[model samples]
Target: MTGSAGGRRARRLAIGTAVMLVLAGTNGPWLYRFGTERYHEYKINRPGYKAVNGHWDVVEFPKEYRQDTIHAVLLHTGKVLLVAGSGNNQDNFDAKRFDSRIWDPVKGTVKKVPTPADLFCTGHTQLADGDILIAGGTKRYERLKGDVKKAGGVMILYNENPDKPMTLPEGTRFTGKGNGKVFLSDDSVLIPRATKVFDRKTGRFLRNNPGYARVVVEAPKEGTRYETGTQDGYRIGGLTGADARNTYGIANKLGMDKRDFEGIRDAYEFDPVAERYIKVDPMNEARWYPTLTTLSDGRVLGVSGLDDIGQLVPGRNEVFDPATKTWTYTRHKRQFPTYPALFLLQNGKLFYSGSNAGYGPDDVGRDPGIWDVATNRFTRLAGLRDPDRMETSGTVLLPPAQDERFLVVGGGGVGESRLSTNRTRLIDLKAAEPRFVDGPRLAKGTRYPQISVLPDDSVLVSGGSEDYRGRGDSDIHQARIYDPASNSFRRVADPLVGRDYHAGSILLPDGRVMFFGSNPLFADKADSRPGVFEQRIEIYTPPYLYRDSRPSLSDGPRTIARGGTGTFTARRASAVRKVRLVRPSATTHVTDVDQRSVALDFTTSRDRITVTVPANRNLVPSGWYMVFAVDGRGTPSTARWVKVP
Candidate 1:
């Protein structure tokens, strides 16, 4: 053999070895998972997954909130509104000491805002005018009688004046009603104050305190009137003790107390531009644990919550017309479980995904289905193996808005059981007969996992707990990015602080993610061991940001007409591959129904580009959207707000 021929053969062998090494290192055994479309479909829990690149940093907060922020919504003006009604602690509510702030992410400052009502546990949605309609919260706590029996404490379900017998959960309790003769259902009718009652059979309540049942009653009273055109005024009261207990907890008890909190029918419009909260016309009925979704017609739909009387607000769906700045009751009545994670289908229907933030009867509300707003009709979707475990879970409408697909991820077990789920599911609403299909699982089961739609079209799932709320050390700090194309999740960098219930994340206009808030049992107790309330702010920079030079918009109109085309200059136009308009997110309870990304059709030459707006209001609702120019490597530029009128 010739010496030159031998050298060429060795070179070919070296090249082949390098290629094999790259393939093995990148995907290993799961390389075939991405090899075909069928393979990708079944790659829900694929092994040897590729981890997405990202890093997190804890930012210094300008001032201490002193309260746990259980709710956060991003505003169009690039500031975040933080609300923690009563801070999940009634002591704050009793004193009328609430924490509401506007956090400027760019300036690292928080401006305190006074809340008109207890915004805690309320539903919210962004209006087309970029204002937030804050609905339903505690007016005040309610008092009820509880009888301690050998089996369990039986709570008199008289708060709402129920016609039938209703059972309350075991852990549900009320407190601070004043010391008196406690009543027991045993052979003994009366027990002295501060005496513990023992339930020998269940071995559960073995304390010296025998729970008592009493008929301490209070009538509904007229509340402070806000300027609403609905009626002369609204009344507040008749709420169950259980509803109060679930939200604000029993009034005025210290250390892990859960007995205070009531549902207030008061609603408000938070104007970010003016930085003021305007008391709006309240809802016709009260709602706690409700969900607010922006409809395609530019109206906001309010659904499923405990009424003023603390019963699940039944079949009375209302729509808030931003045009009129008022809530109009729908002629149709609908029943949805509390906080049913609802999404607006492109065809102008609501899809209830069986994801809730924990409330109501377990069995009835766990069904996932689609509902027509006009006729009030429902079509059930099957195939969720752990449908009952969706409490405190998170769901998102997959990006490119036109896809009409949804994803549900990470929920807890039934009824405050501390058990969470790692399962995730996906469904295509555009399917002929849509049903849930299994998707990739999380590293662990998470409760309150925040799902944010990233600019690159991948979904970011981060910050939750394996147990109920933020109990124990179960807070999950790790984050995952779901890639729809691959049908898999790439684990990303973990945050410094672990977040669970009440924690939230939103995609900043600058392409970074801002993580904030976590309200555990005693998360606000800084003196307590392990402290409380994951209050520090953290920002995550995705790997794409470090990949290549990002495209930037130098000059663009602040507003555009529907279906119109305009020219904008983007520096580094040669690197630009995609231009997108993303609606700023209004998030709470791990759900952001208003969030979406619409790709803009564009033609580019040199440093100038002409982009066409969405053809109609249905495609991209008339509102302010963050416009970005994404480079070929998928890194997005700092967004500029563009209003579609």
Candidate 2:
């Protein structure tokens, strides 16, 4: 009887095992994917793996505190200032719903600050007094050709009266002499007084060169019939006598074509401590995508942007005086594409990397060169590969400002083109003839790569799209550390989020890097759905931070003047082998002209470390900086804020 029972049980077990194998075969792919994902998570989270490749964590603010951040600046207070004016949202712009946020990364707190204007696509830089100088913004969003209903174009308003300027208010009508088409000014314009030109050789007057202003004018009603193709003189309405004769307008075309974004002249100074924006004198020119670079003398230089008339500024640059809180035009004229990567050289000249965000003629101002702002002379640099693919590229002043080396990262073709390059270029300004040479290549062609100078003297290059605006789901998730000492790139852990257009990274005070903003053109590989702006901020803790422990830095002087010394207490002072004075970053569109890691001469004692700041004003600009003490193992302590007054 026992033998019969054992045979029956064995038969039942065989039947069950066969049924289970059949079910597993039916769901093989799903089971494999689930197991693979679980294994990845477990591997990345492992302590051993983290110690080698670091890790990434996402910071998602509450729904009410979320914003479409377009620009981020690391303030002196260790809080990040996030600005998202209208946030590339046309609906928000129409409703005047601008946004700015102050986030404390350590405390995980967020606060909203009232934004005064549409600071979208504006330029910002760190000031001498720890304030952030913000200038330019969007005045009008772009309207595509098919979406444009009004017949509108640029109108050159002429003021022939040398005695006085003319101001034309919005809604001012202009009737063309030939076509008799009535077009109205979309915004108010101020035309300067006519310049009375005189012959240089003789005392006799040559003629009155009429002072003109370009304004966008549109037909009163929307239709293709109101479009005009030819140039015509226009009669000004509500003007009589001399006003009528002196204030006429001339326009070459007024057709229902695409209209690009217009810019505003609004400017402000953001006070980090007070957590408010102080209104300052507006810029001389309305700018949509400008760059604010710090001059050697401490004044702020504003350059390269789309003007109020939706055209390039025509090389008319300006300067901002912090003491006077005013802007004055520079004597020289030099044009560039919007947000050109201009860095200040130790010799007090400016270097243009030919890296720009967008907007300008392909042939004009596309060459990388050294610019003499004083004389308006540009000396072009040779050996730049893929020069035609410079738009959206990133330029970084390599670690140790004393070296005067720069690296230009990957970029894409001009305007919405699918072309991209994986080449990296390096230049040494200290050389007799500084020219670009090929460096390490990226795994894929990239654009909008975020480059940050780490405290350990290595640069972190991460995040970019292989196509324009990450179209076709081409956002690269890779990160690399470029060692200037080795002149090579080492691949690190991949980022969790995909960053492309409008994205940037900033080195935080805690020795980690923070990334913000990603404006992709499409969401899927097939480009079927419109892409959404990435609002979650991602923090990357480098491998150096995953070690056993970091050196502790404390009790440092709040201010250190140029060519001065400051002593700070560090328990692991003997292990501290390097000291770096890193300037805070103000980044947008992968352009960060403010950040540079300056090496400091240091001596370590039993329990204290003394560091000396460089005497060169151009090398170490007057501002607040993060003083980091790196141990022998390349572990950096939490930064101690120091002011270079």
Candidate 3:
């Protein structure tokens, strides 16, 4: 009897060992599985996926909660808030820390949001009301015990004061608390798989538009609302109309295959008060990843995105009038907007830029073109502004009213595919001639979690998964800050965890960033995850003590940091156009370049149109892309274009 028992024990031990090896994924075995499971799918037709690259740089944050990725970072006053999400059930980095956050940047420490013993959640959404709705994740994502799967939707909500974070919201504090507001209302969030909300009802997902319409684009049969976009002129469906689905190219990257891609129409409306979704008539052909911007007329214009086969197609621009319930499509004479940025000038002229950039395939890369409504023409901006460059681009209109100058940041790099950028570019559209100025580069190769400039002139960057373990690797804490005035990063803060694939960064009247984090996958866990996919709120304040704008110093520093070839001599071109540079900032200029010719000074009664790059050694951070901006009244037509390596 004893011998028989020993043999059985031995058998059980061997099996457990094998299981551990499989789960631990020691070496190539783990790599192979990850590659096959996710990366392989992307590598199916494109080589870009196979070349998952990483640019190295030293990071000051040393402690690892086992998991950490900067997802969303925002700054307010002298404080900062960060929101981060986790891809793994453990929530910690790879193997540490829980997956949620609400951190203080200046404090240099993080506070964790504890999961109630009886509560379960996978994701969260934030509402403008300052409460976080935790819903839709695998309430039972981990409920499968020894075979039987047990999943439940346990959505919960939490609120914290940005100035004084909730030390025990009701009882416990959240790790991913501060930074921006999380979307929590049922109407504001979406569950890939149907999620069960508890309490007074967290709400549902609806599209908020000017016509005061609450739009809801239903999920495809068994489809998790993967992506959404609209175009003008083209039929609702691509190629043909009968099959002209209003949404074009909405697909699931991690879900079921074959049905991975779908086309869509160009029109939609939502009724916020009613909490209902209604799809309007279709616009035109299939346009994927189109940018929707609200014009001064309260209309929305979607710029150049792309079609199937990953190519930039014509028939791109579309305009929608909510009041009139009408949508118009326009075919611009410029290159298709692959991943371009849209800027609305005070004069009402629209500026497009930073979309899928082209290179060896000149035809495609050369497609980066800018369209001017006033001139009704497409003229590519001079300098690094190239066609075919589909960088992850967006525009920032400065000041209270938001007019005149615009800031354009990273969108891929020289000769790289669009959708990503490494350097920052400043577009001075207010100048006689709009030009691209060099700003700062991002930390190494990481891309998403999105970036937003706060009301106080500070740059907030957050969230994005690492290549392989990229999802979980990108916790909400991957947050950082950049001070444009000093051209330097101001320490780290806590953030949230999640890919934030299609979340909207709405600017609140209180100056807080309204962050909406959503996943476009129809995974079962998302359904069971209590909060679903929607908004998550976090309040962020910068650490730098704003000492009011310093008065211009006479004969100060005479330097411009242009990547490698050294500074340009400003002597011959010392005069900056008052209409373009000096006047905006009410500042004047004394110009010279490389010390020998790049020194220039200016006075300003108003904010300058752009700023100049300092030309001193160690003047800027390495691996940082440099953008030169003037304070006010300078000729943008003569703005220099360069990047520091």
Q: For every model shown, what is its TM-score relative to the native structure?
A: 0.74, 0.97, 0.40
* Deviating ranges (above 4 Å) for candidate 3: 1-260, 295-298, 305-313, 331-335, 355-369, 385-390, 400-403, 413-421, 465-477, 496-500, 518-645
For candidate 1, write residues 1-645 as lDDT tens digits. 556988999999999999989988987757665567465433422322211457677876655654577678888899999888777665887898777889888877788887777888888887777788889886655333231111111223222222222333322333323422122221111212334456878867554432322211221122222111221111112224653332211111111112223466678888989988898878877788788987878888888887654567777889888777788888788777777788877677788888887667776756889888888788899888687788888888888887888889989886668678899999988888889998988889889998888888888888888888776667787888899878899887666688877778888998888887776753432424543666677888877776546788868888888889877888898888888889888777776777888889998999897888877576688778888888877888888788887
Residue-wise C-alpha lDDT for candidate 3, range 1-645, written one tens digit per residue: 356888989989999989877777657677678778685345432433212210111113334422232223222122222333333233433343334334443364544443222111111111111122221111112212233111111122221111211111111111112221111111221112223333456466433211111111222233323212221121111123422222111111122222111123434332222322244555543344344443544455654443322234464566665556566765454444333445444444555554321212345433333556534576777755422223333344432222344444443333322234445566565568767776666563433335554434454565432221123332234555555556555445444335333333432222233343444233233233233333333444333212222112222223324322232333212333221111010000000000001222322333222334333322221111212232222112222323222
Candidate with better TM-score, 2 vs 3: 2
The collision pairs in model 2 are: none
Per-candidate clashes, comma-separated: 20, 0, 207
By TM-score, who's the top model here? 2
lDDT of 3: 0.34
Candidate 2 similarity to native, TM-score: 0.97
Worst 10 residues of 1 by lDDT: 226-235
RMSD after Cα superposition, model 3 = 22.3
